[model samples]
Target: MDKITRIIAYAKTKLQEDLTGHGFDHAQRVATLAHQIAKKEKAQVDEITLLASAYLHDTIDDKVVPDVAEALAQLQMFLAEIEISAKQQAEIIFIITHMSFSKELEEKVTLSTAGKIVQDADRLEALGAMGILRTAYFGGSHQHPLYDPAIKPVVFTDKTEYRKGSTVINHFYEKLFLLPKKMNTKTAYEEALRRQKFMETFLTEFYQEWEPEKANFF
Candidate 1:
């Protein structure tokens, strides 16, 4: 097997044990999508490392590892096992570390092209119709209220406050809706729009379901 594929396969084995909504399956899909768009974007980064990073980005998120530092250290060590260069490992870790919007809330780090690609792929998973489903699924898993009339969305300057906010609808306002604007490439931006539309549709349907006594008539 090729090096990048081998890296992802190894990571996938550990991640599959979690089996949560945004688990290994989600990461694989993101990596696949990123691969679809990577060549067109002229970000002077390594593609294999970027795609590998994309697949493993969420390994420490909600699935395999709960502790961020521990997860990263573990991932770094795994890369080391296969003779992956320190420089390449650093770049992959940087993207995985900074690519998260949740982490962004806690700390800010400017990402490289590889990071950008990985981030875009991850964000796409949260934006569209499918993305909206994943968002609701994740928010539900976290016990977040889907809609709160009183709790409006917050405009976050970075990642810390973003993680601090609750409510699934607020997630759209705080990040998903803004992702298209934050995209680093045209293809990624266009893909963002597709996902954004899905999110809007989901919110509309979700709120409509809340109409008191309306369901009785229909």
Candidate 2:
């Protein structure tokens, strides 16, 4: 099989045990989204690096892997065994390690075109209908509440604080709603805005159901 296929298989194996939204399926969707965004933007990018980063993004994530150092070592060894050049491997690692929202919450790193596309794709996954479900899924996996009016969402200036977790509904304001403006490409921004609207509507209905007496329709 080609190196990209092997990389994808590696990611699948690593993410198979994930109960959070950052599973193999989510990685695959990110890859697809990255491809679509790349095409729409007509940006010159290293397609292999973009696809590999998209598929392998979560494999070494602290949220997924028990030991991130070990995971990174193993990933590097695997890339070498698969004959991916050191340069390509470096590019792939850079994209995955720096693309996440939590990482950006710490500091924004300038990205290559491929990295930007992959980043936009992953962020897009966190914005729409799927984004809503994934947020709730992750919250449930981590035992975070669905909502708590008494506990408001706070602005997270760093990854550590962001990972401390928040209510499912609060995640929309904390991260998801902010994605559209953060998108790297015009195509991703437009799509993200559309998805953001959907999530907002869902939240509106959710609030109504949560407090029927206060619902305007009542």
Candidate 3:
């Protein structure tokens, strides 16, 4: 098999049983989106590195894997076995490690063009209709409340605070609503605006349904 095919096979195996939003399907979507964005962007980007990073991005995520260190070590070996060059491997590893939203909250991460494309693609997955479904799925899996007027969204000072006591609805306020402004590329930025508006409309309808009496007030 080709290197990319091999990487896809490995990723599918790793994410096969994930019930959370970060499953193999998510990876495939990100990979496809990354490729699309890369093609549209005028800036030069390493497509191979971006696609590989997209596919393998979550394999070593601490949230998904019990032994992050071990998983990363194995990933490094896989890259070597696939005969990826040192520079390409470095770029892929950097993108996968730093592309996370929680990590972005902790520190400012500067990425290469390839990294930027991959990050944009992954962020795109967290918007629009698919974004809504994924958020609901994650909330259900973690037993977070769907919505609560009494529990307002907190401005997260750190990853821990962000992860703590989160309701699904509040996630839009804290993250999804802000993603359009955070997009790295122009194409992605424009796409994000459409998705962001969709999310806002959905939220409005959701609240209306939740409290029909208050619907007329808005």
lDDT of each: 0.76, 0.91, 0.90
* Candidate 2 global lDDT: 0.91
lDDT at 173, model 3: 87
Q: For residues 1-218, write the lDDT of model 1, one tens digit per residue.
A: 77787887876786776634667788888888787778776456687688778888877674446787787777888888877888888888778767777676677788877787788888888777766777788788768898888898877776545655579788888777877987877889998887777767777777778785665545
**Candidate 2: where is the Cα deviation over 4 Å?**
216-218
Clashes of each: 6, 0, 0
Native-to-model Cα distance after best TM-score fit, residue 76 in candidate 1, in Å: 1.5
Candidate 2 per-residue C-alpha lDDT over 145-215 given as tens digits, one digit per residue, 9 for 90 to 100: 99999989888897888998889889999888888999989999999989988887998899899998788
RMSD of 1: 2.6
TM-scores of all models?
A: 0.86, 0.97, 0.95
Q: What range of 10 consecutive residues in model 1 has the weakest lDDT sum? A: 156-165
Distance from true position, residue 58, model 2, in Å?
0.3
Sorted by TM-score (best first), the order is: 2, 3, 1
Global CA lDDT computed for model 3: 0.90
| Model number with the top lDDT | 2
Q: For this target, which candidate reaches the highest TM-score against the unseen true structure?
A: 2
| Model 1 quality (TM-score) | 0.86
The parts of candidate 1 lying over 4 Å away from their true place are: 42-44, 62-64, 157-161, 212-218
Off by over 4 Å in 3: 215-218
